[model samples]
Target chain A: MTTIIVIYGLLAVCLVASLIKSRQKTKKAFLVAGKALLKMGPSLLAIIGIVGLTLGILTPETIEKLVGAEAGFIATVVAAVIGAITLIPSLIAFPLAGSLMRSGATVMTMSVFITTLVMVGVVTAPMEIKALGKKFTLLRNGLGLVAAFAIAGIMGVLL
Target chain B: MIKTLKKFAIIIILSLVFIAMAIWLPDIAKRSSIVAWDYFKEMIIIMPPVFILMGLMEAWVPKDKIQKWLGNRSGIKGMAISFALGTLPTGPLYVAFPMASSLLKSGARVSNMIIFLGSWAALKIPQLIVEIKFLGIEFTSLRFILTIIALVLVGKLMEFLLRRKPDKEYVLPGEGN
Candidate 1:
């Protein structure tokens, strides 16, 4: 809700400022935006479908069951892998993490899940590759997974 | 047109999968469709303004200015600016991709842009509040500190690796250089 308002508000302000400066440039901005949006159409749709499928299949209960049933390093690996592939909205994900923690999931597993969930985007890789190129996407995500594990290991020790 | 259709092959396959799920797993299908529809609506509402903002940036912000502000020699200042720009916005990571692309074209360093994208994904303000809520202050603070350190390391590594050998540049659709 706030995100929408802030974005639209910023857009409205920027659009007006650009229009006041030069109608031609403002029109060009619109053209660029439209072209980029059109170019991204397929990848965006694919991501939405994939997110739906992943989240639909891995409900919070299902996730709890999966992560809870496992223990030790294997559980952390499972949590991280699931987090990497699924793009669950943080709103649902944090609470799910809380519940998982209560259900005996380790800090390492929960932290790994949350960290990878934010940093990695296997499902959205097509869109990312389209926007940022294949190499950039792969390197960023690959490094992100490594960092997630490191962070999780530290959190496990400290917390 | 054919190229466009080829790009959409994944979507077509996904639709078939959805149809199959609807036949054999109606409950999952129903849930999936509802979740997808919600996300679709969010995307429709959020993406236009984001793209428009990126377009405005592309049109208005000069390349040299971007370079000076976020370029390699910009140093610590550039990283700070990138972090500020990233953390201020509240959106999914996808929304940052186009903006990052535009900035990169304008000569922003890969390291700085990595910081931008990293903070955009992991260090959001609202996201922190939620994390603190469910996960506790100690846990949230620890992750935040660790994430910053990790992001800087990762960003510098990417910069080094990419500079050693540049990757294929991607041209936007309908764009001609």
Candidate 2:
């Protein structure tokens, strides 16, 4: 993907710059990276497992059924909760939202799904807490969930 | 050994669950492993460079510089920089976490980092293009505006609350290295 390429390119450029400027500092940077990577290894594996479970169980068809079965306020809430829980990649999530919209899912529900999908990240919470601490993770996600609903409500009303 | 096992308890439990599913629910287990393997591949590819970038920032960028650019006094300029950095074509939200952690250690404001994280997750350019393609321009644009507004408010609120009771356990492993 473009993202992977961009990151590799950025890393190559930055690494070269750092090496040319100060090989000692570049070496230190690698040390820091290695240590952090080692520290995060367990959490990363857990995250992978969770992502797999979430996506496998809540495939697009299943998600469609869950969101489409309900309407009005209930559907919107279910959509938001599902969005918050799952960590669907944007590539899959956006297109899924589009199809769901076409298939008679309400605009409010789709908007809620998209907003929560992007803004929240329940599955990534362990890794996030490890890096940023529990308070930061909790507050950011808590606020994000609230904001997602608000944004979805406004979008639903406006569009 | 016990400490290490405890640290890895979650993974151990997950592995057991996978095994259980394989026996009782073979189909779901196969599907789950496939999905997990796919993501594990992606993570393996992406994580090294991301951590390297974070390390490079830590070593090369001076703390005062980060503080001046993204600290409390950074104001609108800080927000702009955070927004621009966030909108870059980074891979995922998890990648941003370590980088944001580095920035926090270097004295960036909580609110600015929130903006950075929020934009990275919600308002990246590539993601917007995809949104427009699938969801239409009108819907994409409206959501964009609303998201931006909501993110700023959320960031400010978090900044205020954190300032009141700063998290004492923000340190990561291998600090003082």
DockQ of all candidates, in order?
Answer: 0.83, 0.84
The superposed Cα distance between candidate 1 and the true structure at residue A95, in angstroms, equals 1.1
lDDT of 1 by residue, B1-177 (tens): 998679889999999999999999999999999999999999999999999999999999988898889986888999999999889856899999998998988888888888999899989999899989999999899999999899999999987777666675843221111
Q: Locate the minimum summed-lDDT window of 10 residues in model 1 chain A.
A: A63-72
TM-score between candidate 1 and the true structure: 0.96
Candidate 2 yields a Cα-based lDDT of 0.89
Q: Where does model 1 exceed 4 Å of error? A: B170-177
Q: For candidate 2, lDDT tens digit of each residue in B20-131?
A: 9899988888899999999999999999999999999999998989988988788899999999999999888999988898898898888888899999999999899999
List residue ranges in candidate 2 displaced over 4 A: B171-177
How many clashes in each structure?
A: 0, 0
Candidate 1, residues A6-29: lDDT per residue as tens digits?
999999999999999999999999
Checking candidate 2 for backbone clashes, the offending pairs are: none
* Candidate 2: residue B125 lDDT (0-100): 96
